[model samples]
Target: MLKFENVSKVYEDGFKAVDSVDFEILEGELLVLIGPSGSGKSTTMKMINRMIPHTDGKILIDGEDITKLNAAELRRNIGYVIQQIGLFPHYTIEKNIAIVPELKGWDKKKIKARVSELMEMVGLDPKTYAHRFPKELSGGQQQRVGVARALASNPRVILMDEPFSALDPITKEQLQGELISLHQKLNKTIVFVTHDMDEALKLGDRIAIMKDGSLLQLDTPEKLLHEPAHGFVEDFIGKHRIMQNPDLMPVTDVMNDKPLTSLPKRSPERALSIMRKRQVNTLVIVDENDVLLGIMPAYDLIAKMKEITKIEEIMYPPEPFLSASATAKDAILVMDDAPHGIIPIVDENKKVIGVVTRGSLLSALSTLWIETEESE
Candidate 1:
């Protein structure tokens, strides 16, 4: 747990990067700090690990004032990752990841084991990537090494400043997925800084939107989207709130209308063909009436090749179907647990109307933001 009390920061040049921001982060919660550049989001994060000292007020970690702790020791207990990744160019990925543990005076065997464990934890195969240098790895791969290094010492808290910003959108999403999965397992208290509203909404347990070096609002993504504190907050969120909320809108209203490739009865070969062709992970399962049946995920199909021969064999019931009349928020929740990135939308008659994929929702959100910005 972490707490900031009346925290503020003013550079010697007299620019305030943060202003009396106060908040508490619970254990295992992910708190997102989001705002435009120079909004003090980064300054706020730095104070947690004492990377930047607070100009005023006090910061406490687990009830102890962080200012009282030695900076090096305090930071050792906190994991930090940044957009630049900051891995040593000359060091192999394993060596880079082992830096923290080594600094902590861990023995060679223990440090190596931890490095291997962390590499795997972040989805990088230790056997393949451990000995590779930073320059040899892709941006996303380097970022994973950064993450692995941060956790090398088993820190209870993690600080991330736009950790995914340097990568392509596809890679960024992949890392975000990995981060979410890692959080669910590790449950470390996380403070993340970003300018991306969508990322904040997806990963944050609560979001702190800042402006002019001051805290604007701190609340759940739903609350922040549904009830912005002021015009600035509204403008910041743009008009994407509607698409982010799936409960009020139906899938038909936002679902992709293009004819989708479907598999008659799920077969590993058929599912693989469709997925490979569409570059998708999901296949809609329907009966003669094109009625909603279930969904077969590409991963599941591949993992259970023999069973996939029968649509019913590989088909797992959808999390729960949403009606066309349902809100977009409902759709979001439905898709949250969907592995295939698809959610089924049904008619009142319980017949399948269509499906909403992640791409559709994101596109709708972008358009909504542009439309709202233009209106302004």
Candidate 2:
């Protein structure tokens, strides 16, 4: 656990970058520190590793006073990822990831194995990327290597300072998903700092909202959204909440309860009539209970109307279904793997509630974009 007690940072220039702040980061939790520029979010995080000395208060890592720990030794045990990536331009990917383990004096063979494992873990095959320089990879790939190097030592705690902020929106979302997956599998305690509230909401277990160097609130993302502690909290989250709405959108809002064209059995004539009458491209297959079984495209019907005997034989399961409450952003992310541009929304009983299509999500996103622009 990491504990901050009355932590305050006052620069030598007599500016109070951080007020007396207090918080405890539980083990295996991803805590996000977020606020506007110069809100002291970064200052609080930097103090933990003594990258910047605090003027007042103490920080304890696992109950040990960080002030007393050797700076070099403490940093080695804590993984750090920054927006700059900071990869050694001269070093190969293999050498970059192996830096810490080498310092720990692991044998060459062990280091090689560890580096290979890290490389593969970060989706970089050793044979392909291990020898490549930082400049050889794309921006996203370089960031991936940066993350791989950070985790090279398997540190229990990680500090991410807007690690994905530099990437394009699509790349940022991809990296965020990757990071979430990695965190789930690894269960590392991560303290992430970001100016983006949506990023914090999607990634953080708990979010700390700061303003003018003072922490306004620290709570779960859901709580932060539904129950803002003050006007400032409300304004900040409310403004950015829509960008993260795709992840929070409920499946019930988009699923089709009485699908215009649904199939119950293998009757080509009936299916053809429904498809032609409704002028729909796809038909949902359901059992007697109205449970979604699969979907059959109208094109498939045109080709196999006479050949196929049963809907089950021709129908293929939809890519994947999501809960109504899931944000559209998450659905879109899932759609990256499924270019179909539609996601089935299921209820608690696993019954189809509605369908959120690319068009529907985009419509909702457009409103958010307009509203956000107006607010700014």
Candidate 3:
């Protein structure tokens, strides 16, 4: 967890990069900072690892003031990914990722194993790229290496400063998708800085909009889209945005349209691999045409992992599901019955189209209550 209390950054020239910022980043949450050029979004993120030390107020990591901690050690414990790939060209891909752990004095075997695991997680085959230099890989591949290197030490907090801005559209989209899946699986606290509003909406659990170095509004994506606290926030999000009453909003408005799924015929090992790669605890089972079959919670699959071969044999019936016509109210009512805190949204034909996660449903209901209180 990270907390900022009246934080600000002022240089010798009297220019304030960040001014009186206050927000707490929850553990395992991905918070995005977005604003126009010179908005201090980047500065806000840099202050997390003391990359840009704050001039005033306190920045705490799990209650420990960052200024009191050693800057070098703090940085090594926090992952950082920048727009430009920062891998050392002379060092092999494996060595590049192993840098942090090596600096921490990890055993050779442990570092090697961790590097290989991370490479696979980022979609780079360690067997092929481990010994290869950064120059040999393409831009996207190099960027993947950069991500792997940042995640090498398995840091709990990751600071990504417009990391995908430099990539081509196709690769950028791909990396964003991967990052989303990775976040779901790993649940690392991430503070991502992006100039793109669309990127912030898609990636952030909660977004903080900054302007002229001051924190504007910090809220969930739905909260920002539905209720912009400041005129600048509204203008930044665009006037064309739909202004829906949270009480009447359908589950579709807030649900994750892209839910991770798996086939029923996979072996426990194969199924487990998919879950780990996707970074999900529950896997929705679907047929070839993607019709809902059953639900496989990670615990159930693991318990039966050695005993059974096929996951289909142990998958439970997909109950407590949300129909396509379901509203946010319906989701809230049935959430407690969800086996793994996941309610799959199925169409009339029984095809899984999306999912209303516990967190999303709770946020919607909370927003509804808050609005009701203000109206009353």
Best by lDDT: 3
**Which 10 consecutive positions of candidate 1 have the poorest summed lDDT?**
241-250
Task: Return the top candidate by TM-score.
Answer: 1
Structural similarity to truth (TM-score) of each candidate: 0.69, 0.69, 0.67
For candidate 1, the lDDT comes to: 0.83
Q: Write the per-residue lDDT of candidate 1 for residues 1-376, one digit (tens) a residue.
A: 7899999999999988899999899999999999998899998999888888899999998899998999999999899999999999999999898888888999999998888888888888989998989999989889989989888899999999999987999999999999999999999999999998888988999999999999999998767766789899988986644543444334555786553535466556866887789877777777777677778777777788874467577577766777766766666667778767887877787677777888887787678668767776
lDDT for 52 (candidate 2)? 93
| Model 3 score (lDDT) | 0.88
Scanning candidate 3 in windows of ten residues, the lowest lDDT window is: 239-248
Off-target runs (Cα >4 Å) in candidate 3 are: 241-376
- Residue 250, model 1: lDDT of 44
Better of 1 and 2 by TM-score: 1
Ranking of candidates on lDDT, top first: 3, 1, 2
Please write out the lDDT profile of model 3 over residues 140-220, one tens digit for every residue.
899899988889999999999899999899999899999999999999999899998878877989999999999999998
The Cα error of candidate 3 at residue 123, in Å, is 0.6
Question: Cα RMSD to native, each candidate?
Answer: 12.1, 7.6, 15.9
lDDT of 2 at 296: 78
